[model samples]
Target: MNGLRKGSLVTVGTGIQLINHITHEAVQSIRNAQKVVHVVNDYPTQRYIQSLNPDTESLNHLYGPGKPRSETYRQMVDVIMGHVRSGLNVCAVFYGHPGVFVNPSHAAIEMARNEGYEARMLPGISAEDCLFADLGLDPGSNGCQSFEATDFLVHHGGFDPTCSLILWQVGIIGVGDYIADGRPSGHIGILVEVLREHYGSDHEVVVYEASPFPYPIAGPMVQRTTVGRLSEATMTTMTTLYVPPLATKADRDMLGRLGLGAPQRS
Candidate 1:
């Protein structure tokens, strides 16, 4: 412990969009840090951060075709820890919410804490946050369940088909490595088959991708298609599946248990 140097690590999110999603606190963290490292999806956000702090470095270079995403994440953690070890106040920025499904951000924070450094993560607007707004959805209404597409298929997680289901990372469903062209070629058919089991062949579903740019005014791609036509929908690395409820609510017993009166059936 005597030879160990004291450093601090702060992880923040730039949100899913450009500069508009960035919070004032997160902006201050980037400006005040001795060194800044980031991984973002688009060039505009990257340039925005660089403009705020010229010393900023991008970790996106670690990703490559055929390279395992896990390996790339580990490398990202190493780069962040490297600066922290150099006794610099390091700040790591990621797209969307830093702690939401970001392996490298979590790994770097854990490693920094283990090394006796003060490490913290700040929340930012995630794709789900945008989805709820753009889709006119309230999670409290009918209840919402979210899962990674791969995990949902592999584990066959118990979920209610009568409620809203959100599956993330659908475009890269079965792939474990990075692809330069962002085209994934694995097990999409299997995912569609599994979904049909619960949603039925004609059940309507939506493939959603939140717009990252503000001025472009690109809203979510709400494709109203059956479960069987899922494979035909255009998907991207950021695409998420939204499954709406099939059953209408008429549970009088449950409603009475909660001390609520039942509504008149139409």
Candidate 2:
């Protein structure tokens, strides 16, 4: 601790788009911080943060090819904590929702709190938020479930086929370490096999990736492929899989229990 001064940490999101997605409060936090550390994907967003705070530093340098992602995340937490321990007002920025699919942000906040520092995360629009908007999807319409691809496969999670499914990290399946120049191997095949069991090999699915830039894009890379073709599809770290619902099954016994008539097809 520097003197008796209190050090605080605030995590904020840049959202999916460069400048447009950041909230007014998030920007103010960046402007007011003594030091800012950011982890973002695009150059324009990084430049904007640098312009807002001249003391901005990027945490991206912690990442390396062949390095385990967990190691990189630990390094990120160390960097954030290092500034806070120095009694500086630190604002850490991450692209999209800081808490969503980001392990380091949560870890940093927890560590800071454990150290008797004021720390919290501010919510921002995530890729899923954009997906719901650009794709005209209402999760309430049929219910929706989202999961990490590898976790879903490992746990053999059960999902309702009548509800929509969104699988994130589809491209980096089974990849424990970071590979800057190469993609993962064999995970896609396993994913396909698992999905085929539930939805059948001919069941249609869509691969989606939200655009970080503004171009009035209607939808992501919506590939209409069967479960069997998932391994053959073009995918990236950002790719997400969308599986539409199967046919709604009538439950006459349940309807009768509720003193209601059976469902009629429109």
Candidate 3:
């Protein structure tokens, strides 16, 4: 028993694009694991994962029409844990960063650690990374704040309009169950109403979706629309809303306290 190999778990991300953005470390983890369980969006990526490991299994079948996503996530965690308990090294792969907006990955890792199993997560490119490159916007230029669309509306306070605001899952805002069509069934009208108070009707916003395919195959969807017209914009399960910051003057008092003059802007 003492000489037997112990169970371990490693979670990785396949990034937004199919196969193009997978990291070397993530690839190694997938290739070396005894079992590879994944939840990738595209068929090509699913095939790619299978190529890397013959023992690959998909958790996508857990999702069903009208099923609560919370239950699906719970089931996914249980499947991953089952592999670990059998003394097999398991690799769990998710689309985009495994740690970003992935409920099952975090839950599985936490549960594994709690059960005295070795578990860790590797970093991968997220949708936000692709957004910055495709949109040519720098988060450093203005501070960035990110939140789920529903959470932002429910706990709408202390969020600065002067900084770049990103609201994820705008299409599925209030929807808790899985749907086949992945439509914007959520209350998008409520989101538009709330944003109108902060940035006004004419303020431009982007309805963006990072392409799951490689470059030349497809490019990201970037729909620039005003706050007033957001309700009419195209939104899907993959859509993320990008709200540019409102222009504001610098704080003269803080500059004075720092003994600095006005900084030049580009």
Candidate 4:
């Protein structure tokens, strides 16, 4: 079974945009793999992945209307394992960072390693990276908090409105099942109410979608609105909500303890 060790797995991300964000290393992994499974952005990206490896297969067909996404993810992981168990070097690529929100990527890697296969994940640019670039927001400037919209509403233990808040899957706010067309989140009002409790109704927020194709798709889409008006904001399954912090005084005692002065760096 020594040769079976050659049947390894590597998962990578295609990033947010098409063609541009794929890393050189990930490109090599795709080309070298005996079999590649991809769940990417659009047709063009699919073709690009296909061009890299003729053995590429798409898992998009696994998705079904009104189906639970957890099952879909499980099936995806199973498919990846099938390739690996067959002693084929497998590459499972997903959109955005493979490690970010891609459940199947993580599940497949864990399962592969558990089965004594060499499995590793490579990082790729995510929507969060594009959000930082497009919105000119820095997590370091003011500590940032990120959460899935439903998780934030249903089970958030604590969150700081005094820090930037990013709510992912804003367009699928309360959705429990998968929709083929990515139906607009029907319960955005619940999210707005939760945010309104922390930051007042008039506090500004943004609905952001990073462009996938870079044109007519509205490159790096951004819609600015207030917490109260968030319900009126446009969003898709890809949308993320950004809530900036309200003005607050720095902790003078902490600064003094650290022998530092008031804010100076920009």
Candidate 5:
């Protein structure tokens, strides 16, 4: 501890689609780091990281069948911090935006900073970013609400039906463990039940997954179905459910208070 050089940490994301989606800054961080530890969704990304720096290693081995995801995240933090404590300039890579739905990346950064090591995170393209682009939806058009599927159900907070709703990890709701096959949890039915309370049985929803490859190679998966048939739809670990806003009218009272006339209908 006394003789080791000062350690530092930087976490970055590869984005949903590799190579193209990843920022140059993130790529340079991976290239310059003394050690790189990553958990990417696809094999192509893994190879790309290794190509950037031969010292790159995967954190995927930490995940095991039936292992609690929380435990795996803890172990990942430990490993990343271990490298930092050894006086290595460590780069931690994740699939999506490092700060989005990634527990270990945040934990490692916090630990590194607390232990007097320089640590920071860089932003990357996220699944939601791709979703917005692929679906031609603008959050500013109405409003947007996002939630983890289990949290949406467990917390039971009322959401706006007049605005868009996005539920992430819908395929794995209520699943706390790592499954080898990326199986859908049985709890999705519960999510359907709850969503129906807000959107109704006949409300049309989209089940979407961003393609790991670029458009020419593979397009994003977009499945349209009614809320009533959601339980019967195929869902995977990466699926995100999009519930569009219902028909909504502007509040004339509020518009009048602002001294503005009613918004012209398009």
Candidate 6:
């Protein structure tokens, strides 16, 4: 048992853009790994990764119609760990931040650690990061709340409407399995209903998709629409829902407790 220790694992994110968003540490991991398994969107990015390491392979074929994405993710973890257990320095790369809603990367890292192998995840630019930049939002000012679109629909309670809200994976509600043709998401109307309880039907919301390219080259696409019209809006796989803050009065009681006297409101 003592002699069985072998291999190492590192998970990295290439981010949303081509080469602009990837971290230097992530590129080094890809360059030095004995094996690399990745799932990226375009052929140009794929070729770049292959150029970094000839051992690079893609896990895109694992997805199919009628196959649960959870199953595919589990298979990805298994494949990544398989290489790690075989005395190879394995790199698993995903499109966005490796730990942000990336189940397989987290799972593989946990599995590798449990098996007594070294494993870690490197940070990369996520859509949420781009969202703040493109929208000119300072989350520090008003605070922010984030959740998956489906989970927010069913389980969100006590959520403050005065703070900014970010709903991820808005185009894939009620979708548990992979769909090959990439059809429009079906349950958006229900999502609108849930949000309407907090924000009125006329409350403006942004249906946003951060562009894969950097700003000005091809900027982030932002569509400002009311909550009522969100159901009618066209959504793709990358769409995210941003619900801006509503008006709220400041709590004078809390302000006094903090020893800060009431200042003039801006």
Measured against the true structure, the TM-scores of the candidates, in listed sequence, are 0.92, 0.90, 0.95, 0.95, 0.94, 0.95
Please provide, for model 6 over 112-154, each residue's C-alpha lDDT reduced to its tens digit, 9 standing for 90 to 100: 9888998999999899998988898888877899998877877
lDDT of each: 0.88, 0.88, 0.92, 0.88, 0.90, 0.88
Better of 2 and 5 by lDDT: 5
lDDT string, candidate 5, 27-56, tens digits: 999999999999986888899999999998
Q: What TM value does model 5 have?
A: 0.94
Residue-pair clashes, model 6: 0
TM-score of 4: 0.95
lDDT of 1: 0.88
Task: Report how far off residue 131 is in candidate 6 (Å).
Answer: 0.6
RMSD of each: 2.9, 3.2, 2.1, 1.8, 2.6, 2.2
Task: Report the candidate with higher lDDT, 3 versus 6.
Answer: 3
Write down the TM-score for model 6.
0.95
Q: Give the range where candidate 4 is weakest over 10 consecutive residues by summed lDDT.
A: 1-10
Sequence-dependent TM-score of model 1: 0.92
Q: Tens-digit lDDT track for model 3 on 1-266?
A: 54324899999999998899999999999999999999997899999999999999999999999999999999999999999999999999999999999999999999998888889999999999999998988888878899988889889667999999999999998888997797786499888888999999999999999888776758889999999999999888999999999997888998898887995344
Q: Which residue pairs clash within candidate 5? A: none
Could you tell me the lDDT of residue 190 within candidate 5?
84
